[model samples]
Target chain A: MKHIKGIFAVIAIVMLSAFTTVSSGYKIGDIATDFKLKSSDGTSVSLSDYKDAKGFIVIFTCNTCPYSVAYEDRIVALDKKYKGKGYPVIAIMPNNPDVQPQDNMEAMIQRAKSKGFTFPYLMDEGQKISPQYGATKTPEVYVLQKTSKGNQVKYIGAIDDNYQDASAVKSKYVENAVDALLSGQQIKEPQTRAIGCSIKL
Target chain B: MELYFYTMRIVCLLLLILTASCKNESRQNEKAVDLDYNEDFSTVPLEIYDFEGLKPFLKTNTDKTYVVNFWATWCAPCIKELPYFEQLNAAYSDKNVEVILVSLDFPKKYDSHLKPFIKKNNLKSKVVALDDNDSNTWIPAINPDWSGAIPATLIFNKEKRQFYEKTFTYEELETEIKQFLN
Candidate 1:
């Protein structure tokens, strides 16, 4: 009976590890593959479209989430400040249209227009991109830099330390990563986490 | 005759002061009763905390099972699963189980959003507000499996601790609780 229990324990451990590996998304330094997703402006947007760009600020955001709404201005500010420095923002709406009607293509277009977004608000149809990046929440960020290997994910997580008050934010995680890349310096903090609404199925 | 009249005057003043104090006490008691009946029962004062202050809630070090739920007013899924947790809290009081709802609402929205929400839902479980700015530090500390998603839960006792980054129905929650029910 003891030998049988040991065998069962090994099986359980192996299955748990396998499950974790299947669920985890991209890690830092992983090469992110490009996607040609549809944007709110009736245009196809892809990472490779920006030829002169050094990196991309790929953020997974949606319209309905209050957390996402709070960060819209900050995300816009990131694009405005960093776009001129070769890191343009590429925001994706990854929630299922069925679960979140507010995040549909029509709402995405209206939100982008009203907010004067200086970036493309693309819809991740079929919700494919977020899972690849292992993004589980709205307002999650991934900063990728173009390299000889491909677009290398330099940073993954929140925009800053404080989600509620941007001014009160101490560590600008995404900004610091992009700035380091521009100055040819190694990024200090490569990953961060923030509370956000789960991507609706 | 002069001494007698002075004593009478002093007695009158004392009576007046005593009646005035009596009226004030009754009035204050009336207001307290009114507040209890008033439909405005949302006066549940929240226990606000930063990351350091919030850490103790997780490590209660008691024999009773602790069901700590991380939720926000804005999270739809979290809101949906709340009633189950509330039911478990109410039904399992004698079973040595406790449920705590940790609100992750923004500090700015505490007055306008979180408080009103607690009142409207009539949440029976003890609700506390976690307004910590450093989420990156605390999110992983809660559980490495947590992807900073709402509707997450932590169940623990003296022997074992388990965290879930997903929603649960009453049956599902009770099943997990039963494991610690020795």
Candidate 2:
């Protein structure tokens, strides 16, 4: 009887904690759940598939958002710079095609082709994955660092300080975090904010 | 020495007169624009703002209530619910209520997209472009619970404050306004 009661208590605590994590969104240092979303190339990809990667730059971006458009080239550049360094960029379009026709898979393919994107631009089908990560807008970022337990969210928020003109940017938050992680140092600033188009549901 | 001082003073006086005339000309130009806006509200240019620039709109010292909404031209839900805000603005104007539409339109598209959309829709609410790129800072500053989503609204008066991150129908928006009014 005592053993059964202890097991029930443990189950209840685990369930409660799982519910809380889902509702609160992915915070810094939290273990992020791996998702197998369809890439723009018509093939499904998962974070766990990247065996040699030290970390992943999971970006919630889309085709129609002007803010996303602004960062498209920069995102490509980030992938070029960091993919070989073991932190490849994974772009996800989180908006529902029914609500945002412009963000449809066809558009994603066209954008990827035109931009010469080396990174995988995945579609978050049914809008299932973004809410779990708590992505509010297009171009939001979550830097996940690999650990023995799992991939932990190391940083969250915008790519850089300036979204208008990249050359004039004084602070590159994403680069700073990835570089710190590469050097096996703690991220100095793990979070930032940038104006972006809201994810259409 | 006397002649030199007298010449300098006259030059100074002429410079002052020239400066005042320029100032008056600019003021007249501004007044003319204001008059034009009052006569035809459609041509009013949307003002650009950053997070700090948008602070005054967040909090008010007056008895009047403000319904400030963050939106973009491309956001489907924002477009769908904008009519409710327009109706609320018209219905509650006499009650000292105001609506401020904050556009997060990409800066590059302000002329190509945002301006044309406003003209086409005939948006009556005071629309302003929020050009701040660092949203992680301001989104939470606007409301701690805000996930930086659009179609988000902040309704407030002198005493109470309410923030909503969901799309609202006409009835739902009206009810929220009424709650603040009462």
What shift in Å separates residue A37 of candidate 2 from its native position after superposition? 2.4
The CAPRI class of candidate 2 is: incorrect
lDDT of 1 by residue, B115-166 (tens): 7778777888999999888889999899865778777899998898988877
What are the runs in model 2 whose C-alpha is more than 4 Å off? A1-22, B1-43
Instruction: Name the lDDT value of residue A166 in candidate 1.
Output: 80
Ten contiguous residues with the weakest lDDT in model 1 chain A: A14-23
In the predicted model 1, the residue pairs found to clash are none
By TM-score, the best candidate is 1
Give the clashing residue pairs of candidate 2, or none.
Answer: A193-B134, A193-B135, A193-B136, A194-B135, A194-B136
What docking grade applies to model 1? incorrect
Worst 10-residue lDDT window for candidate 2 chain B reads: B24-33
lDDT by residue for model 2 (B58-157), tens: 8988999999998887666677788889999999999999999999877766776777778767889899988876666787788766656566889999
The global Cα lDDT (0 to 1) of model 1 is 0.82
Residue A168 shift from truth in candidate 2, angstroms? 1.4
TM-score on alpha carbons, each prediction: 0.84, 0.80
- DockQ of candidate 1 is 0.19
